[model samples]
Target: MPHNTIRTARCAALVGPYLAGKTTLLESLLFAAGAISRKGSVRDGNSVGDSAPEAKARKMSTEVNAASFEYLGERWSILDCPGSVELACESQNALMAADLAVVVAEAAPDKAVLLAPLFKFLDDRRIPHILFINKIDTLGDQSVRAVVSAYQEVSTRKLVLRAVPMREKGVVTGLVDLVSERAWRFNPHKPSNPVSLPDALKTDESEARQALLESIADFDDALLEKLLEDMAPDSDAVYDSLAQELANDQIVPVFFGSAENDNGVRRLLKALRHEGPEVAVTAARVDAPAQGAVAVQIVKTQIGSHAGKLSLARVWRGEVADGMILGGERVSGVFRLFGHEQTKIPTATAGDLVALGRLDKAATGDRLTDANGGKGNLGAPADWPERPAPVYGLALHAENRNDDVKLSSAIQKLTEEDPSLVLEQASDTGELVLWGQGDIHLRIAMDRLRGKFNVAVKGQAPQIPYQESIRKGTSHHARYKRQTGGHGQFADIQIDIRPLPRGSGIQFEDAVVGGSVPRQYIGSVEAGIRDAAARGPLGFPVVDFAVTLTGGQFHPVDSSDMAFKTAARQAIAEALPACEPVLLEPLLTVTIAVPSAFTPKIQRLVSGRRGQLMGFDARPGWPGWDEVKASLPQADMQDLIVELRSLSLGVGTYVWEFDRLQEAVGRAADRAVEIRREVLAAQ
Candidate 1:
């Protein structure tokens, strides 16, 4: 695809911190471009982008929403993405589909700090972007200037002023255009009426215009020569340089406006139409796909009411028809998504944001390409931000017993929509667990289960798998005899049990000599010993112990497998109590990365949670963060994450790997032993 061939001239994406009015801005743009008749607000629960029930309930965007509009003879495609840290990956995925990212910022200087991560992402990808200083009507001139300066201080690219706020009686009334040297005062109460710029902003307007021209002059030698000659540069030269620099991300033009009141929105739209990256130029893959084939990237996977699975894809090359093969399967249908509503379209071409219906095998970040019959590798661009590992988990089960099968299928669908969510069945404990980014992320996932899939579930904390082992060696004897029948049963055995090293698990050996016990019955005795060990004297699985059968006697005719098994079970049960059973708790090696300023607090938190700090290292790329490594009992880790998140303001991240199970002694171990013994006796 080429830039000149794109019907949609502009490809821009919106991103900012949570609740920064990104969706509202999109709504305003749509309304201005005539794509929508009336603008919808988030508070009213009627925004087009926030049509999902989960999004409406939370009043936040959980995924990317896209729409296109035409303004001033050029078509524009706009993508609105979630801003919450938990859903930040959605924004990254949107960026991959965008050529220019418009970072919306509030008037408050402190609020601008949240854009650091977004700026870093754009810079790393070498993606061009611009800044929109929004909500100027709410702040004074001095405050707005301070906020602008704060943004300039943080940004590596040149912050060029493309517009200046028109103030009237210490209030922002309109904006002065720096490029055209024109101004208009906005009537907030009556958006249809446009007031003239006040006389007092003349000097400020000139200064801003001069600064804008100087910033562009350095980019073109012709403009520099014209400036050296003390003459104004050609307007076309200035416009060309601005467009080229903005597209290349060398300069970020700041546009002043208030999205809520639609102040300067028209001017902003014109600037985007002129300065934004063309869809055809920007749609070229960051990394090209395989040749002689069409490839489309699925940026989002959304569940619909009656439409079922809708894959929001951007076609990079070629054309997709109703029945064209994608990923080796025929496409069911292609439709354009308008929230929950769908409009079927025939033959979507390159750079179209069309929804593919009934794409059961499609998922977010999947590349749908022409699949050749032969086995050949098709090189596709890597998906944006590899799926994040799930940090929090909950054990879940279907509330209705009959819904068990449906629950598994529903979970699979949810995972397909959001690949970051992880599902696992704990084979050791027979528990089903769902893992996600955080509490809210998991909550929304569960809500989707009941709301979208119509499957209800119950969730609870998983039981920590505990093990029991012996401490000291002990010997015992057992005998079994039956004389009620013609063929009587008789067996005698002596065994010794001892503790093994940690992680050694269970081991068995026999040293019986000279036909002390029949070899045929020895295997039966071992099976009986294992059955006894499955439920130790402490009511838990026994491990890290050795059992030896040193001597045994069996009658040739009377000794049966059952007789020897009973004798062996009785011998082990009798010997285990004398061995002084102890509890062994699973230990996890936990590593936490946090800012150094909070290192002391994190250390204290770990100690309070019964965790032993092993060591600490400085995080490589992060300046103030330190990685703290610790070993903590699995029982103590359940709620520790909640407290850790609270202390670190949700920035701290940690991962744990299972370590060896160790003997748990003292009061905790004693309590566990008592509980296990009570349970075993009851059983």
Candidate 2:
């Protein structure tokens, strides 16, 4: 898109930890912009952004919701994202679509630490942002400074004061504008009331002004020179430096207010209108391919009401109209997404965020472009963060037998919506497994499965897949003789079994003497040994073992392949018990990344789970967060994340990979072996 032609619809994403009032802030902004008549509280369940039934029940956003408001004649697209760490991916996706972010933090210093991961994410992405010190009505003046200092100590960027708390007898009434050097007071109970500048704030206002000037001077050489000469810098110079420093993400402009009470909301909106999107840096564009037509990038995807799939796209350089050809396919229609509602737009231009309806094949990272003679691969930038792998799994089965086909179809659609979800059929276990990031992520997927597609499924933790292997060498002999009136079948076989190295799998070798067993009979003996390996002495699939057909005898006319095979299988079964078999449980290489404060707790938890800590390393740019590497049994891994998240205050993150199956030969392993024996006997 041409720099001048592209409408600058810079977006600001409201994001924080759970219950931080992100949706409420959006509601406040919508009312402040006159987009709505009255503000709707989340408790009332009438908020525009949180219309989904799940969101209404939880009273929190579960996905990204956007609304556009015209402030100072400039279009600002505000995205309200979910705050729950379970839905952090939604916030990250919103951040990718936005040019800047507004991190809302509680006034309490302890609670303010929740913004650490988000701040690091924005810093790494180079997204400029402002800090809204919310819930000031609950904190005293001294507490507010303590919270500010706590944030400054943790944040790498300077936290410059853009607005100071307006006080009356030590009670915060409103905020004093530092740049404007004016006192503004608003009714804390009623946010829409016009704020009045109070004279009682004069002394504090002067100190705030000087603090703001000195902070700006630290960045601007000219302002520093003016400060040295004891001459105040021009207001334009101060604002210019503020804008430049904020745009470069060198400074995080801080404003104090209470979102719930609506105090300082109007001023915050005014500040955003003047300094937010208007000064946002444009996203870097990818150089267009020579022969391909204009391309549009799809940043988000939504399943709309009564609508199939909505591909939320931003046109980089193209005009899309109804029935227009794109990527050799016809553009069905372009529409704007208003919360959960969709409005059909006749045409969508470059830089406009629109929902392309009925794009079932389209995905979150897909690119739509005019095809050059029906041949070209125009796609969005592929350098974005890779989706997390699914480490947790659940076994799912449909309740109604008739809904089996429907269940399969629903699972496919659900997987499409969330690329992180992985579906697989266990070949050995013959069970359907749904894998996801964590327990909550998988539960949400299951909820969508039932709610969106009406596919009722029973979910449970999957059974641990265990293997049986031998520990010592043993030999046994078997003979099969059957009499059937005229002809008789007879065969004799001897087999030797031995344990192989871990993960070596099963191997069969024929070491029969020249005339002891026929060539055809030797093949049958090997097949029988392979079949016996399927269900070892413990009834679980055998692994990491080898078998050899040492010697066997076959009657020329009476002994057939079936006779030799049956005899060999019986011999191997007899040899397995004497071979001293053991059970092998799957081990997982679990890597947990958590705040340093919780390291000791995590180590203790790992120890309790019988895990071995391999090492610990620091996570780059994230102070007080350590990456802990450990190897844990797969069975112990269940619900381990729940404890970790609780310990780390939801900032904990982890990824696990399958290591190898090792012998589990203690009391627990014996119990598993006993259970397998009972199950096999019953079968």
Candidate 3:
């Protein structure tokens, strides 16, 4: 009982897998706390969370939604986070600022695997968390044992069941508090009414209560003594011990509820009020000053039409006020966020999550402190979540060519807002490519470009940097003669083209004798040869070949660098067809990561994509996981991440780099060439 856990405000995050009902639970909690008079349904697009238009259209949470409420004279900020693996960075960033995280899970054994990665993150950071088994109303004789057992396998810490579901005729109707030994009946959309314990569950309840006591006793020697001597522990003592243990992240208390029915939300809130850790403990963990200074961390940023830039931040310590100069930027406004609505708060103090208006330079993941004497932040940035590597990519272009500059500016703003959004100007293809976590992640980014910035853009799979080179060698001679109005252009060059080994790239050699081609024009000839090799007869960049300027004659007065360059270009272009041009496709050495259970499937997936297996080993630092290495064709990597997630319960990912170029043959080469020709013709 460190200060009995009573702070003016506390922040909690709702995190779970997609469609696990976190958004629904947010509405229920707001209702239970009396923050709203009526609850709104997500299906109707009226819920407080998921208020963004992108979320509404997709019927899923595309970002983090922060809402504040008052319960029993205490203030709380609940961050409802997106559950898709594509947006896990949002949840990870918000979690670093939270005092406790409520892991909302479905009450089904099959869906337990989805919690593994999330649980590991929380435990590794020592963040206090609780398990609320949601949607219990869908249960028919809900096997609490089956659900708990399934979750236990993934959780490294212990799980203590705080309540047992009360069932009648194979249908769960209510819950019996294991700590208080009191039974309550669900009254849908209202407060649960107290009821006497049923006789049939008395024995089952006794065993469950005993198990709960033992789990808590493991962390308390005194409690262990009491349990060892067969002496019953007092309910009040049990509550205090459970609260302390939860604060330390030693255990996760389990509760059963149906947010759709508001069945156990009140009881869950009660547990939070008593068990959530105080602000001081968390402020120390984040290295925020204990007192006398303002320290805030920006978790999310947004662009508003009228209000301008909005920075959603958690006040770590001290008071933040409007017009105050912090980190060299004046705060335009300080307000609390409630979905689309903002309440103007004069000054936000410690433990408050607020939206600061128009802090121009303060970006997400930035720790801004007002006390550091012009240093800006708290000496060093706090522990921030890293932006995940981009797994999916598309070449983007403005639909209207006139909007090209505007589109680039809009994309810059979007990338600044979300670091996970990556923009790359492809050097080989000259395409503006946007990379993100998945197809839907980039889709939302593009939607914002259109909806918010009024720029319409089209996306397509980025083209592979395919190259072509000569498989055989040929020698040719050519001359350029152009009569201008005054001086005539005349140049002659004899060159030899030869195939180099793989990875040799394009090379230029000078073997001219006795200044036949002047030193000044020799470089121009090589440049011209490279330009001609850019697009061979195969319509791709050429590589892995060498060209030698054997002998060339240039007139001192008539031949300029341009004349020699033209002659060199003509010689290579004519010789390329005779030298037998071949198409060379790029290859990538991709390392696929997944749980060992899915190793076989990963192997099959690689083989199906014409990938050559390079063996697999246990992923470093990750137990029960394997990293499979393979060399795959660049064309086949477009949708590989999508299929990896599908096969591995949305947790698999891969990283790849250009390995080498191999000659393309058969239908693959013919199809690619045909497509390239059609594209060139259309242009």
Number of the top TM-score candidate: 3
- Runs in model 3 with CA error above 4 Å? 1-7, 289-292, 378-382
lDDT per residue as tens, model 1, 1-683:
33344455445789987777888888888877787888898888898787788899999887788776556555567889887767777788778777788888888786554665577678767678878877777686565567778777557778888887766688887777777777777765234344565677788877777888888877778888887888977666787899888877788888878888887777778788777767556655365355436777777777754567877877776777898778766678988656556777677777667788777776687777775741222423654676666667789888898999999999988887887789999875678999877777788888889998888888776767788889898888899898876998888988888899988877889889998988988888888888888777777788888989899888888999999898988888888878888888999999987767678887798888778999899977554568999999887876666777677655566888999798788887777767667755785
Estimated TM-score for each candidate = 0.86, 0.91, 0.97
The whole-model C-alpha lDDT of candidate 2 against the native structure comes to 0.76
How high is the CA lDDT of each candidate model? 0.77, 0.76, 0.88
Q: Which ten contiguous residues of candidate 1 have the minimum total lDDT?
A: 374-383
Q: Summarize candidate 2's per-residue lDDT along 315-423 as a digit string, tens digits.
A: 6555678877666566678886667777787877655667777766667766667777533346555545467666578889898978888888888887766667789
Number of backbone-clashing residue pairs for each candidate, in the order shown: 1, 1, 0
User: Pairing residues by index, what is the TM-score of model 1?
Assistant: 0.86
Ranked candidates, highest TM-score first = 3, 2, 1
Error of 3 at 35 (Å): 0.7
Comparing 1 and 2 by TM-score, which wins?
2
Candidate 3 local lDDT, residue 203: 97
